[model samples]
Target: MDATMENKMGLPPPYEPAAPNPAPPPSYFGDNPPPPPGFVAPPVAPRTTVITSATTRPGSTKLGPGPTGTTCATCNKSIVTRVEYVPNNRTHIVSAALCVLAGCCCGCIVPYCMRSCKTANHYCPQCKAFVGSHQPS
Candidate 1:
């Protein structure tokens, strides 16, 4: 190159579109394809699982539990009247709540005899039981 051309602006040669580009046909790529004329979305899933406790349901096969106590797992207000256990996925959730002004009491007590679909970390080593919940206290 000549010295006059060397003293030109610092910009390099403008990029030229290369030949023999391997870009595929339009059928193989996109952000999203055009939907069919009459497309319909799929259904949503149920988040909470079924509760298999007997003390709350006795001979019932309901999904969620009854109630909670005053001394709830959240607050120590001693207001709980019954416990509520909701089976979510593979964990058995334990919730404590309170009855209204009826002065009745409620609490959740796991039978410790039966558990199902335990997570790997929550499974008991000695008894092979599933304690549910990932939080360690």
Candidate 2:
């Protein structure tokens, strides 16, 4: 190919280096500032009790024993009670299939009304670790 044709070939342009970014400004508190008169910093809580799980269920004071005193396999800390709503097992799927096949009758909706349709899964809210699951009887 001629020199003009060579230059017109599918070749990328030359690379160019970008300019470096500027450093951030220093903080207002360079090292440590003196505390105000009669002012004292609050004491820090221990790491063990730093995280706590709050129950989301209303009017339900009872908590499952799955997380009580059980050491977390992930965070290596004491497990706390946490309730999570999870889909039911094969029962829900079978019920749904039967409902569809039965022309979605009123009686077919009974499966959806049953309380055993869903289950509760206990997990750590801190690191989102899977602790265990509980199926209602």
Candidate 3:
């Protein structure tokens, strides 16, 4: 191969250094700049709030009827009564069998009709921690 062919297959060309940045413009104001006339600053909302000894912070608590005297072990907050329907593993097999044997009506509708098919999962209202579950006997 020729010198030109060898150069083409060789390493890439050397990189060129970039030009130095131009000097920044001088500051018009020495330090603080005065606000324009009649330009009243927007009123800031007052931060005053009633301090409470309760460990539960505002916006941190869950929205629901909190169960009285029931303390959460996870977040140390009061537990609340919240019913969560979770799919039952045993019922899932039945549902799948019904789906295969019967049409969409029995398969899709039977599971929802059976309320006991799903396990009730109780969670903490504050931190959404899993408190306990109640399975249908």
Top candidate by lDDT:
3
Per-residue CA lDDT of model 1 for 55-105, tens digit only, reads 322112221222222122222233323322324432334322222332453
For model 2 the local lDDT of residue 30 reads 68
Which has the better lDDT: candidate 1, or candidate 3? 3
- For model 3, how does the per-residue alpha-carbon lDDT over 1-137 read when each residue is reduced to its tens digit? 66667679995555688769968887787687777898988899989888667555333433332332355667886555466776788678778888888866557657766757877666777887766666666
With candidate 3 superimposed using the best TM-score fit, by how many Å does residue 18's alpha carbon deviate from the native? 96
Q: How well does each candidate superpose onto the true structure, as a TM-score?
A: 0.19, 0.35, 0.39
- Residue 28 CA displacement from its true place in model 3, Å: 93
Best by TM-score: 3
Going through the candidates in the order shown, the clash numbers are 17, 0, 0
Candidate 2: tens digits of C-alpha lDDT, residues 88-128: 76557757677788876554666555545556666767778
lDDT of 2: 0.61
Q: Residue 73 of model 2: what lDDT?
A: 60
Full-model lDDT for every candidate: 0.36, 0.61, 0.65
Flag regions of model 1 displaced more than 4 Å: 1-9, 18-35, 40-49, 54-137
- Which RMSD values do the candidates have, in order? 18.4, 15.8, 13.6
Clashing pairs in 3: none
Ranking by lDDT: 3, 2, 1
